[model samples]
Target: MGLTSTASASSEPYGHYYDEYSTVVDVTDVGADATGNEPITPVLEELRDDDTLLVFPEGRYYMDEQFRFTGFENFGVVGENATLVPANYYDFAGPQYRLFRLGVSYSPGDRIRFEGFDVDQTAPDTGIRTIEAYAAERLEVRDVTIHGQHDSGTWGPGMFNVTDPDGTGLVDQFRAPDGGAWINDTPTAGDRWRGPIGIVANQNEGTLEFRHCWLGAFPDNGLYAANGNGKIIVHGGLYRNSNGANVRVGGNGSEIRWPTVEVDSTRPEDRSQRGIRIENGRNITIHGAAVTITEPEPTSHAISVMNTCESARIENTRLELQGEDVNHGIVLSPDCGEATIADTTIAHETAGGYPFWIQDSDRTDRILAEHVTITGAAGDAGGFRDGIRCERNNCRFNYVDIEQPGRSGVNRNAIVNTANELTVYESNLRASQHPYIDIGANALVRDSALESSSGREAVCLYASSTGPAFKKNRLAQGIRDLGATDVTTWANTYE
Candidate 1:
């Protein structure tokens, strides 16, 4: 609650910024000492920008060093049950550590504020960083509460680092829960303690808003931004147990709305966690996300719109994978450019792979999936496999709904196209051990409804498949073109 500047006339009638000239200063009236051994950084650098507010009333405020705040315009820092305890990284005072270093380095300031504190680094391993805001043009960190174990080593100290680029901000109701625990045991630091990253927005060119946050156990990323161009908005959150990606947006036009990600495998060295990773963005938008992967390993992917992402959109998402090595739910790699997934609901149980994975390497055009709904639960001799593994090319699946139940191994196809302009409109594929629409060259099955029942044909055209068109399809088994030349089965009705 701070932002009022309009009282010039050398304002200073009585303490606490008399009437908005700002100067509250109450670190025990400049003597500083709240039980945890003195040293309040010279009374907060003599009230840093001099228009200060710095009021830490309540308890424990023992800083061994590093609280530097350079060039402030309308600065404010209010704490009420105050607690900023860090003094054990070899007894503090080390090469540029941080507990609060606001502005300086391409300096440019205006209204910086940090409210209601609680940065308790769990005593000792202080690798620093619990609020580092540079070049602020309006940064307001609200209701903060970060506790212990940021791991300590390669720059790990869980919480906020906002790098401004004509900034516009609001990191509201933040709460970091035991983020990234890697007690530095040097041996070439292989996992690097998962690189403590939980709320990092660099190169922000106006528009950085993260509201209602509660990030816990960030192993690498739990809300990150890179190579900015501006716009990073993660509204509403509860990201937990991330070993890699739990919300990573590479700026250009970012957004991750209504998030509720919870991945479980209990830190098995962070077996490749992924919830929402949109790299190389350009109109990226993930709406109503609810990704839940419980006890699964083998490179988790619950939504990854890869590099060179352009015109992306995942609507009404709800991806759930519980156990049995969950892999992909939605992944479009290899020069991904044009993508669109609507009304999604991908559910897995004993899954061992694809629900939707369009990867082929430099051959992506328009991949549009409409009203998607893929459900699997196989495993125990023939794990739940493919659902939609297109190799990317003019892809389109409207009204899609794929269900894999029980037995189906050795590449159990439910809809696997090798890419060459494919479209399965009004789809509803059901497989149990193979073909349900595994095509190759220029395929199109309009008004579809293919079911494999128990394998062996429901449309399997390989062997250099060509211009295949089966209109009005409703096959229950039968349509094999191994040596295809130009297959066409119109008005199909095979039972």
Candidate 2:
């Protein structure tokens, strides 16, 4: 449908919400009538006061190197099924065509909604980015698909080396004089280097929401909203197979933050590196999501909870570790804030090692896990041990089931408590290959079952100061003191 003929516009939709002097112009009218050289600025310059530049439906609206939509609030651009196409400024001089590239930059709080459009970057300005919403506030980019597919490079080396970034990051910035300038373009440059994600609200304290959209293969991440205290919500979309993480929040060295990433994958990856990674940010929550990542060489963990995160919650999620040589289900390193893992299942190790590995950074940190199941598949042979493993003074496991098959299979323990004051209640640990009772300091094992190989000790209490208490338990062979602190058993009978 054409923008002006809408029921709202026919009866003066602008009159109800806007002033009389408001201008409405369809960007399709700016094209070349004779197919030669036509500048689109004059058509945009005619924008009157309170005017809404209604971009027409289903047509390519080309832009010069740098199209500036600035200093205009209460007047915005709205279009459906419209594509804002960007091109480079080519200067024909001395038989060689020199290319100048430009990017689209906008002001803050510009209530603009770019819906059902594809921003194409198949031109020069290989370093050109699509929409830079610097100082922008409340910009909503929905149902917009953006990709950098064309090759545009001058000489020398380019900024995006898709294969390897050497030391520097994937993206580098350039100063465009008039939108189209020869950027760092080379043979080994990355694809999707031209078009950037539509809306980027960096350093601007505005709320940005990306819903039902496909944003991928860009030079930077699909959506990068950071620097300032901005709320970013990405829901019902597919973010996959990119140079960087699907979504990245919080920049370098900048701590004390609150950012949220909520996703429900349409298609999942078994070997996903890190679904939602938090570096120096507080109050991060991920709920009801399934992440399947390939465990490529040097396999990345499913989730890496880094330093000083105040509150992190992962609920009703499934993490399948499908990697090659390296894999850790969840790596909770030192000095973590407060972490909670509830109602989750982890299975099928494509690579090597355990199901859940928790390494400590500092002491006295807190972790609570409830109703989590850790199991191994056929590919997961012998050394697939330790369901819940943690360092001293770190974590607590409740109502967890860590099990393995026959004695010929590799040993696996239910709860490997390496931390002090750790407690495991109402859980079952039955492994045929390894010992069942793997305890550390001041740990308490209550009302649980530890079943091991025939004739082997079911509970092997490791040497520590506070002898772990095994109460109301049923075991195959019973508890073994590996020089542990003290072994206390109450009304427990073993075979």
Candidate 3:
């Protein structure tokens, strides 16, 4: 009447906690203690079966060792108002690492479902991995939360991987908000500053989707699912402060959308916590994401498109870079293949950095910024840079706006182009100290408004820079030519 303890409790009505059609094998029915006293590793080994459902009915299930099973056809493990308490590092059994390792990369389950469990790792030196699910196809992990910090420095909370090329997975509503400490501070013997990650899927080879997951700070990276030959889609999550990048992703056809990434805290041994880092991949896209960095270092940018990417696009995104240090907003790496930033706004309110810095790596480059706006108060930016410091070739800016007010700087131009063959069309550029656009060779500016609020030249032609055509632009303080050859201008209104 209270709780059914039948040995053959298959397809029987077992209280309101389960349905009549819920054919399950209760852990207590198979000689497992539900009072959180003894270890459940022995009970799980005796009761684990294929094509079965293992249910943990309402109690604290304690685990002192890892429960590993692999190469199953179909399996499911669900808990009803259950809490899994793992033992401390010293008291745990062999390896003392993870609580559950369902499948390995080589031999994985075909269909795996792990849902509805709360983990508690609050005691000293009592952190362990909650789940490491490696399924070949059709994985569903939902509504699992891990409470307390990870101080034992084993593995992180969760790791999910789809090991086949045709596999698909979905991990939904997985939240671990307490984060973790560094490895040096924990009982784990290491000198590394980072302890573990919140969740990882680095060995994935199939399509994996994470929806509405929340992860807080760890010494290492947070939500790092980047290094794999699979497609990773992060849809609507909140990823906060970490040492490296908060949301570091790399895969072909990967997308990060509607994610709120913020970095407001910095540890003592922390390096840089960039908001979003596209480490390496092809055809990656970031859309409708908001990244805000309040406490950042020199390398902590809102978004950094790294050098090993084939192509990346950022559209309809907003970035806010605060602090009194040198922090950039959106940086396009030098060797990254053809980038596009469209319909985005970057507010770089830092001390000394550019809102947009297309790096000056010595290679042939091409980038396009369309319908983008860059505005902030970076008057004392380092190197006296501009709002857009572009040192690449064959770049184009269409319907763009760059208006960073410079108060005390030597070269705070609106756009500084040091490379060849740049084109600016139908844009508005305004600077406070220097020229609006530093004209290089083979440059073209047409149908634009170039203004200098500090009464400087609208266009500056460097020495030995040849072949520039300026047509139909409203120049504020006119052009300043310094020994330039083959300079051509027509229908430009000089003020």
Candidate 4:
């Protein structure tokens, strides 16, 4: 009872709205074990009430069953210096999945906050979800750390959602650094490729923000909040080594800002480790991201813009990739809509891949890349790799610099475009291989410097190409026109 007086919402993660509750009950004072000897699930059921705060004192609390509640006015579980020991897979009660189902999707709670619980799932085959909450109005989950490799094939650490469209939620500093393995590696799941995700909010319908959350490599994904029809904001997080995609989000008005995604390792069953995947969303933005993949899988990419995405904006992002595998920087799918990449740089020294791979998309789906820098080939490419491979039509690059050094052979180039209505304006394109700039039909290369390091042709118009225009450009080893018709060149220094 003495420890309950020192509890205050001022030191909480996002606790400006918590009111002063009149009743505060200690779990140990109400027939609960503090020595980690007995399960406290029954006592928690009895202690559940409205407009009250249940504070766990300094001790290890063991719970084999879940404690669920919903549709409450004001209820909070505060555990400042406490550790929750969950039972293993076979010994856990009920569904053997989650430990706390605070508010389900149907009977959502109001103004719920669960804070300061350090979960100890260190036993063999011991892993459970610490919280699965769905608050209708205000939800705040903070300072929850799960110290174990979630190998039990259950749900991951946390799952939160604000049920109402007008509600808001915040999950701050929830660190689950020791990620999980595949479901085939665990004992509970049978023959599954992937396991649980780190923090899931797929059913969210309101505004939810994840701030400074650190997630290690999980087998399934890092932050799987991609399908919810709400505003999901990830502000300042370090999401590393997760398969599929580290931080995958898609919703209306969603944003991933100041995120650091590192893929330095891979599991045996890991297929790909994508940095950020945006799908099934509109008006999405990824800003100020540092995506570094030192160890990449065969299909791994830094950022993937799926075809279901309506529009996206990637600005002020930096990508550094180094590996002996085929990994790309930013991949735009074929059916993707309008996209914008601005103030971004990609340093790809991988085995083979493009820095920017704009697939063969529809002509109406335009793309604009401005102030981007791409330089690589410090390591030899395994195959033909270009700095930018634009196969889609109606793409534009403005004030861009690409220097792919053809580390292995002369088959590589700076820009290889098979698309029509292409424009490269005010850019510096340099390649160590022959034909520094390879062009297709109906393209304009204006106010740009094109050169090759091996003293080869600066531009190569394909034989099948029809129209190409070069104006006011400094060319080094002049153009090699391979039967390209309607070739227009004016004010171009052919040196």
Better of 2 and 3 by TM-score: 3
Q: What is the full ranking by lDDT, best candidate first?
A: 4, 3, 1, 2
Range of the 10 consecutive residues with the lowest summed lDDT in candidate 4:
12-21
Q: What is the TM-score of each candidate against the true structure?
A: 0.42, 0.73, 0.93, 0.95
lDDT of 4 at 80: 54
- After best superposition, candidate 3 residue 317: deviation in angstroms? 0.6
lDDT of each: 0.72, 0.48, 0.84, 0.87
- Error at 313, model 3, angstroms: 0.9
lDDT tens readout by residue for model 4, 199-293: 99999999999999999999889999988899999999899999989999998989999999999998888999999999888989999999999
Ranking by TM-score: 4, 3, 2, 1
Candidate 2, 64-164: lDDT as tens digits: 53444544443444444555554542432221111111112332323342334555554444323444332232233334443344334322111111111
Model 3, residue 153: distance off in Å is: 1.5
Error of 3 at 439 (Å): 5.6
Summarize candidate 1's per-residue lDDT along 419-467 as a digit string, tens digits. 7878888888887755454457778888888877675677777777778
Error of 2 at 149 (Å): 3.1
How far is 159's C-alpha from truth in model 2 (Å)? 18
